[model samples]
Target chain A: MAKMNLLQAINSALDLAMAKHDNVYSFGEDTGGFGGVFRATSGLTEKYGKHRNFNTPLVEQGIIGFANGLASQGSYAVAEIQFGDYIFPAFDQIVNETAKFRYRSGNEFNVGGLTIRTPYGGGIAGGHYHSQSPEAYFAHTPGIKIVTPRNPYEAKGLLLSAIFEKNPVLFMEPKRLYRASTGEVPEEEYTIPLGKADVVKEGNDITVLGWGAQMEVTEKAVEKAEEDGVSCEVIDLRTISPWDVETVTQSVLKTGRLVISQEAPITGGFASEIAATVQDKCFLYLESPIARVSGIDVPYPLCHEKEYMADHLKIYEAIKRSMNY
Target chain B: MAKDKKHNTEIVTKPKWFDKDSVTIPMLQILKEDGSFHKDADMPAYDKELIVKIHDTMQFIRILDERMIAAQRQGRISFYLASRGEEAASVASAAALDFGDMIMGQYREQGALAYRGFTVEQFMNQLFSNEKDLGKGRQMPVHYGCADLNFMTISSPLGTQIPQATGYAFGQKMDKTENCTICYFGEGAASEGDFHAALNMASVYKVPVIFFCRNNGYAISTPAQGEQYGGDGIAPRGIGYGMKTIRIDGNDAFAVLKATQEARRLAVEENEPVLIEAMSYRMSGHSTSDDPTGYRTREEEAEWQAKDPLDRLQKWMMNEGWLDKDHVEEHHAEVKAKVLAALKESEKVPVPHIDELINDVYDEPTDMLKEQLDELKDHMRKYPDTYSKTSGRLD
Candidate 1:
C-alpha cells in the first residue's frame, strides 16, 4: 500500500481499467497531453496512445454525446466534464439520451458502459463557476448512478466500480479534496460496491451524515463533540442515488438522533433526501427533530465563501442541538 | 474612436477571398421535374429492378403519409409527420449505401427505414404502438428505430444525433470496417449548436460520416430564406468547415443517389467527412398538429407540390419505359389498399404489457424497481376497470 492523493488514485484507477480492458477510452477538453485542468488524467495519452486517450474539442455537449455514441457500440467510455459548473450544457444529453437510452430501446440498444467524471463542490475559492455541488441534479435522474468519494482510497475503489457498472454513472470528485485528502490506497486493483455508506466513526449519542468535502467538516465537528463528552457516529454516503438507506437508518435507529450536512444549498439538496429517508425509516426511534447544516440558498459567493460554506461550526452546532433534544 | 499607434500602422482593406452572395457549389440535377435530363449529366448506374424498388418505396411512403394524416384528422392516432415532398432525399440516399452502413435519422426519414426493408406491418405496429412494435411503445409514433437494420432510434431532440453520428463513425474507423455512418437532419436542425460542434469534430478528426441535410424549404413554419441564415443555404457552411460538400436537387432521385455514392466513397476510402445539402420542399404541413395555411399561402404549397419527388421519379421511370401512367396509378392504389389493411390490423393488436414499462431501465431491475413495479401492479389490479390496457395478459 502507498499513500496517494485523490488525483493520483483517480489516475491509477483509469490506468488499471484501461490496462485491463482495451475497449476503455477517455476524452474531454484539455484532458490529453496537458493531463486535465486538475491533472486527473495526466500521462494517459502517452501510455495508451491518442486512439484511447485523447483531447476533444471544447464542447461539453459534444463530449457527452460522443461518449454516449461510443458506449452504444459496445465501448466503455470514460468522459470528463472539465468542471461541474460547465456540465449544464450537456444536461440534455445526459438526462434525455444517456438516462433514457436503455428504457426507450427496450433493451435492444443501450449505452450501459459510460462513466462521466467531473470535479465539483466548493471550499477551494474557485468562485461560482468552478465550485458547484450539482450532484442533486443527477440524483434526480433515473437509470444513472451518482457517486462522490470522500478520500483517495475511496476514490480509487468507487471509480473502478463506476467504470464497470452496466449503466451510465456520474462520478463526482470533490475538487477540494483532490490533493488535501490523502490515504493509503492498494497497489493492486480493487472495487468498493456502490450505494454503500462508510461509517467513519461509531457512537451512540447522535448520527452525523455527510459526503465529499463535507465529510472533512463532519470529522472536525465529531472531534469537537467528543471533547465535550458527546459521542457521535459519522457516516460518509459514498453514493447519492441508490444510497445506502439501510446503513443510515440503522445507525439513526441505534443513536436515536440525526444531523445531516452538505455543501449544497439547503433547499432540495441531497441532504434533504437523506433527512427525509431517515425520518421516515427511523421515526419511532427519534429523540430529536432531524437537523441539516448546509449552505444557504444562494449562489456561492467568492468573498464571503467561508460564511456561505457549511463549516465545522455549523455542523457542531447542529450536532449539539440534536444531542440536546 | 482612437486606435493605438502600433495597431494603426496596419491598414485595413477589403479582401475578395470569398463572396457571400455567390452560390459556390452548384446543384446537381440529372433529372428535371418534367422528366428531362441535362445533356451533360451522366446517368446513375442504377438497374431497372433497383429503380423500381426505389420508386415503389417512395410511393408507399407518400401514401402512408397521406393515410396517416387523415387518420390523425379522424382521431385515430395522436400525431403524424409526413415526409411528403422529400422522398428522393431519403430513399435515394439510402439506396446508395451498403446495408452495413449506419443511419442516424431525425424525425422525417421513414423512407430510409422503408428502403432498408422495414415492412408495412412494422411501420403500422410502430404507429399504433402495439405490443409488436419494436420500440415497445416507449416513444411517440413516427419516432422509429430498428437495431437489426443498423438504424439508431430517432430522438426527438433537434440535432443531438449529429454529434452522435460522428462518434459512431469514429468507432467504425477504429474497428477498421468498411462501413460509415449517414446522419440526417433538416435545415432547421442545422441551426442547433450540436450541429456545429459535430461538424467541426468530424472535420478535425477526419471521421467517416456523411452529413445529409434535407433543406426542405421550411423548418416547421419558418422559411429557410430570411429566418434560417443570410448565407447561400447550408452547403457553404460545410465548405467553411473544410469539409467536402455538394448541393444537389433533392427531388431528382438520380442526383441524390449519385451524390451519396460519391460521398460514401470519400468517407470510407479516405476517412473523410462529407456534407450533402439536398434542396427539396415539404408539401404537407409540418405535422398533424400544424396547419401550413397559418404561415404560408396555398399558392406556395401548390408550387412545392408541383416539385414532388415521387412525381418526378414517376415521370422519369415512364420516360425510360419502366412505368406507364396507368401502371403508376394502379401501383399507388395497391399501396393505399395494403397500407389501409395493415393499419386496421395493427390497431387491433394489444398494447405492450404493463411490465415492459420497467424492463429496460437496467440490465436487471434493481430491488427497489421491482418493489415499485409490484406496487403498481397491485394498484392496477384493484382498479382493473379503470386501466383498459390491464385487461390484456401481462408478461
Candidate 2:
C-alpha cells in the first residue's frame, strides 16, 4: 500500500488499465504530451505511445462521439472532457447514444465498457467556467453509471471498477481535491464495488452524508459536532448515480437524524435525492426531518468562492438544525 | 424527377447526377425512366416475397408517419419524426443487411427501425414515454433504443452516431463477427466534426462500417444544395477519404438495396469500410416540431411526391403479380390495427417506477444515489395526498 492523492490514483488507474488491455485507448484536448491540464493523464503518452494515448481536437462533441464509435467496436476508451463545464457539447452523445446504446438497441450495441473522465465541482475559485457540479444531469440519465471518488484509495478502486464494468461510466473528479486529497491506495490490482458508501467516522447522534469534495467538508462538520459534545457519523458517498441508500438508511435509522450536503444548487441537487430516500426508508426511525447543506440556487459566484461552497460552517449548521429537530 | 433548371443555380459544379467522374460517384439507378432494368448493373435479385415485404414495410411506414403525426397533433404523444419520402432509402438499405448487422440511425430513420422488426407496440411505448419503453421512459419521444433488435437507439443530435457506429464496427472487426455497422445520417450531419473523425478512423483502421448518408434535400431548414460541400452531394468526400463509395437513387429500392448489399459484403467479409450516398427528398417536415412550409414550397413537395418510391415499388410488385390490390388493402388494415392497438396500450402505461431511477447505473445503488432516492421518497411522503398511489408501491 502507498499513500496517494486523487490525481495520482487516477493516473495510476489509467496506466494500469491501458497496460492490462491493449484495446484500451484514450483521447481528449491536450491529453497527449501535455497529459491534460491537471496531468491526470500525464506520462501516459510517453508510456503507451501516441497510438494509445493521443490528443484530440478542441471539440468535446468530436471527442466523446468518437469515443462512442470506438467503444462500440469492442475498444475500451477513456475519453477526457477538459472540464465539466465544457462537457455540454458532448452531452448529446453521452445522454442520447452512449448512455442508452445498450437498452435502446435491446443490448444489440452497447458501449458499457467505456469511461468518460472529467474534472468537476467548485472550490478553487474557478468561478462558473471551470467549476460546476453537473453530475446530477448524468445521474438523471439511464444506461450510464456515474461515480466520483473522495480520496486516493477510493479513486484507484473505483477507476479500476469503472474500466472493467460492462457499462458506460461518467467518472467525475473534483478538481479542487486532485492534489489536496490523499489516502493509502494499494499498489497492486484491486477494485471497489460501485454503489457503496464508506462510513468514514461513525457516531451515534446523527449521520452526515456527502460525496466528492464535499465529503471533506462533511468531515470537518462532523469534527465540529464532536467538539460541541455532539456525536455524528460521517459517510463518504464515493459514487453519485446508483448511490448506496442501504448504508445511509442504516446509519440514519441508528442515529435518528440525517444531514445531506453537495456543492450543486439546492434545488434539484443530488442532496434532494438522498433526503427523499432517507425519509422513505427510515421514516419511522427519524427523530428529525432530513436537512440539506447545498450551494445557493444561483450560478457559482466568481468573487465569493467561500460563500458559494457548502463548507464546514454550512455543514455544521445543517447538522445542528437536524440534531435540534 | 427532372432536375430544376429554372433556378439556374450552379453553386459548385463538379459532377452532375449521371456523369462519370472518378472523384464523384453517380447515383446508381438500376431502373431506367421507362421502368426497364439497366445494362451493366450489379443489382440485388429480389424474389416476389422480398419485394412484397419491402413494399409492405414502406406502406406501413407511410401509414405510421400519418397516424403518429396525427396522434402528436392530438396530444396522444409528445413528439414524432417521420420517415416520409425517405422510406425507400432507409427500408432498402436496411433490407440489404444481414439480420445480425448493426444499425445506427438518426431520428428520421423510423423506416429502418420498422424494417428491423421493431414492433408497433415498442414504437408506441417509446413514443408515449411509458414504462414499457425499453428506455424505461427516461428519454424524449422519437429517441428509440431496442436492445434485442440490434438497432442502436436514435439520438436527436445531428452527427453523434457517426463515430459511435465506427467504434461499434471496430468491435465487430475484433470479434470476427462478420457483421458490419451501418450508420444512417442526413447530408447535413456530414458538416459535423464527428462525421469527419469517424470516416477518417474507419478508413485508417479498415473497420467493418457502412457510412450511409440519406441526402434528403434538407437538414431542417438548410437545403443540401448549399449546406453540403461544393464538389457533389457527399460522395466525393467519401472518395477523398480513400474508401470505396457509391451514390444511389434514394427513391429506387433496387438501386439502394443493390448498393447497400455490396457495401455490407465489402465491410463484413473483407473488413473494408464503405460509404453509400442516397439521393432523396424530404417530403415532410423535419419533425413534428418543425414547419417546413417556411423554407420549402408546395410545388417542390408535389414534384418530389410524383417520384414516390412506394408507388414505383407497387407498380413493379403489381406488374409482377407479387401483390394484389385486395392484399394491399388487407395489409394496410392489419398494420393499422397493430399500430392503433400499440398506441392505446402505450398511452395507458404508467411511467417507470420511481425507485428505478436509481437502479441500473451500477450493480447496486451508491450512498449518494440512495440519499437521492430517499429524498424523493420523502418529498412524495411529505406530499402524501399528492403521492398516495405512488408511495404505496415503495414496498
Candidate 3:
C-alpha cells in the first residue's frame, strides 16, 4: 500500500494499465512532456513511449472523435479533456456517437474500450469557464457510465475498472481534491465495481449522500451533526448513472430520513433523482421530506464564489431540518 | 486615416505568394459526356469483369433510388435520401478500394454500400426497420452499416465522420496493414470545424486516409457557389493542409476510378493522406422531405441532367461492346422487379421486439434498465391501442 494523492494514484493506474496491455494509450493536450496541466498523467510518456502516451491538439472534439475511432478499431483509448467546463465542445461526440455506437449498430459495432477523463467542480476559483460541474448533463445520457471518486483509493480502483470495462466511461475527477485528499491506495491491481456506493459512516438519525468534492463537506457536516446529538449516516455515491439505489434505499429505509448534497445547481440536479427515488421507495417509513443542500441556480461567478458553492454549513442546516422534522 | 507612429516601409516589388483566382484545380475527365475518350487523357485499364460489375451495381442503385423515392411519396416508407446524380463518384470510388479497407460515409454514399454487397433485402430490412434489420430499428432509413463490409454506420451530424476516419486510419497504420480508410462527405460539410481538424491531424500524423468530398453543388437548398467559400472548393483546403489533392469530374466514372486508385496507392504505400473533390450535382431533391423547385429552376436541373453519370457509364459500356441497349433495358426491369419484391416482403415482417429497445444500451441491460423496460411494458399493457406493434400481444 502507498499513500498517494489523487493525481499520483491516477498516474499510477495509467502506468499499470499501459504496462499490462500493449493496446492501451493515453493522450490529451500537454499530457506528454508537460505531464498534463494538473500532472494527472505525469511521467507516462517517458515510461510508455510517445506512441502509447502522447499529446494532441487543443481541440476537444477532435480528441474525443479520435478516441471513438481508435476504440472502434480494437484499441483502448484514454482521452482527457483539460476541464469539465470545456467538454461541451465534445458533447455531441460523446452523447451522439460514443453513447449510441453499440445500440445504433445493433451490436455490429461499439466503442466500448474508451475512457474520457476530466477535472471538474469548484473550489479552485476557475470562474464560470473552469469550475462548472456538468455531471447532470451526462447523467441523462444512457450507455456511458459516469463515475466521480472521492479519494486516491476510489480513484485508482474506479479508473482501472473503467479502462477494462466493455463500455465507454466518463471519469470526472474533482479538481479540488486532487492534492487535498490523500489515502492509502494498494499498488496491486484492483477495481471497484461501478454503481456501488460506500457507506463511509453508519448512523440511524438520517442518511447523507454525496460524491466528488462534496463528500468532504458532507463529512464535516456529519461531524457537526453528531456534536448536536443528531447521528448522520454518510454515503459516497461513486457512480452517477446506474447509481447504487439499492444501498441508498436501504440506508434511507433504516434511517427514515435523507439529506442529498451536491455542488451542482439545485434545480434539475442529480440530487433530484436521488430524492425522487428515495421518496418513492421509502415513503411509508419517512420521518420527514428529503432535503437537498446544493449550489444555487446561477453561473459560478468569480466574486462571491463561496455564496454560489455548497459548504458544510448548508449541509449541516439541511441535516438539522431533516432531524427536526 | 491615422498614420502609424513607428513604421515607414518601402514597397519593394516581390512575387505574389498566392492568387485565389488563378489557383483553380482542373477537373480530370477521361470519358466525356458524349461517350468518347478524351484524346489527351489516359484511360484506366480495369478488368472487363470488374467494369461490368461496377455498371451492374450502378444500375441497381439507380433503380433502388427511383423506387424508394416513389415509395416515400406514396407513404410506404418514412424517408429516403437518393444518390441520384453522383452514382459514379460513390460506386467507382468503392470499386477502387480493397474490400478490407474501411469506409466512413456521410448519408448519400448508398452506392458504396451497394457496391460492397449490402443486398437489396438488407436494404429493405433497414428501410422498413424490421426485426431482421441489423441496427435493430435504432437509426432512421438510409443510415446503414455492416461490420462484415468494413463500413462504419452513417451518422446524421455533418462532418463528425471526418475526424473519426482519420483516427481509424491511424489505428490501421498502427496495425501495419496494407488497408486504409475512405471518408465520404459533401462540399457543404466541409464548412464544419471538424473537416479542418481532421485534415490537419491526418497531415500532421501522416496517417493513411482518403478524404473524399462529393462537391454535389448544394447543402440542402443552399448552392455551393456564393455561400460555401470564398476560394476554390474543398480541394485547396486539402492542399493548404499540406496533403496531396485531386479534383475530378464526378459524372465521369473513368476519372473517379483512376483518381481514387492513385489516391489509395499514396495513402497505403506512403502512409500519406490524400483528398479528392468530385464535382457533381444532386440530381434529385436534397431528400424526400425537400423540393428542388424551392431553390433551383427546372432549366438548371436540365443542364445537369445532360451529364448524368449512369448515361455516361452505359454509353461507355456499349462502346466497349460489353452490353447492348436491349440488354441494359432488360437488366433494369429485372432489378426493378427484384427491389419491389424485397420491399413488399420486408414491410410484412414485424418490427424488432420491445426488449431490443434496452438491450444494446450496454453489454447487458442493467437492473435499472430492466426495471425501466418492465415499467414501459406495464404502461403499454394499460394502453394497448396506442402502439400498433404491441396492440394485440401483451405478454
Tens-digit per-residue lDDT, A1-325, candidate 2: 8888889999999999999999999888657766776778889988999899976644678789999999999999999987898788788999999988998898789897789999998876454556689988888897888999888888888999998899899999888899999888888878999888889888999988988888888888788888989998889888788888888899999999988889897778888988988898899999988988887555554333443467787677767778777
What are the runs in model 3 whose C-alpha is more than 4 Å off? A1-325, B1-17, B391-395
TM-score for each predicted model, relative to the true structure: 0.58, 0.57, 0.58
Writing each residue's lDDT as its tens digit, candidate 3 over B1-395 gives: 34454675334466546578666799999999988889999777698888888899999999999999999899888678999989999999999999999999999999999999999999999888777888776566788899999989886667889999999999999999899999999987787678999999999999999999999987775567654565788899998999999999998989999999999999999999999999999999888866777568899999999999989888988988988988899999999999999999998987776666666657888786576556556545654564557435546
| Predicted structure with the largest DockQ when compared to the true one | 2
lDDT of 2 by residue, B106-205 (tens): 8778888888898888888877766678876655567888878898876555688999999999999999898999999888778777888899999999
lDDT of 2 at A209: 91
Rank list by lDDT: 3, 1, 2
Error of 3 at B76 (Å): 1.3
User: Candidate 2 — what's its lDDT?
Assistant: 0.82
Tell me candidate 2's TM-score on chain B.
0.90
In the order shown, the candidates' DockQ scores are 0.02, 0.03, 0.02
For candidate 2, the TM-score is 0.57
Question: Per-residue alpha-carbon lDDT of model 1 for B231-289, expressed as tens digits?
Answer: 78899999889899999999999999999999999999999999999999888877875
